[model samples]
Target: MFLISMIIWATALLGAVMTVWALTWAIKRGEFRNLRKGASSIFDAGEPIGRQTDFFPPVRKGVR
Candidate 1:
């Protein structure tokens, strides 16, 4: 149905517009201005980025 397709397209376009609008609003409101600080705030230097146990591959029970 052409009418259904048009509605779907319009809704998708509207969603995209809203997403861009919200992102712009956040940037204008200074939500993402401190990119460097935000990255550092997430982790401490003394902690490992990942677990040490992940260094080795798991053994397969029955490989062909």
Candidate 2:
């Protein structure tokens, strides 16, 4: 029982840390800026792919 609790706590902590890291990573990578502009650009199909908002998270270790 102790082992199981430790495993669960460790997993939860790892998940929380990874989540914050990813959010900051995205912001630093300019993924959240100009979100409205990026969405608007989608409708303008004729235009080339310009600045876009990345809503998806990065596939990192133990990120499910």
Best by lDDT: 2
Q: Candidate 1: which pairs clash?
A: none
Give me the runs in candidate 2 sitting further than 4 Å from their true place.
Answer: 41-64
Candidate 2 local lDDT, 1-64, one digit each (tens): 9999999999999999999999999999998898988777655565556746566887999888
The sequence of per-residue lDDT tens digits that candidate 1 reaches over residues 30-62 is 889888877767556666455343356667889
Global local distance difference test of model 2: 0.86
Off by over 4 Å in 1: 44-64
**Candidate 2 residue pairs that clash:** none
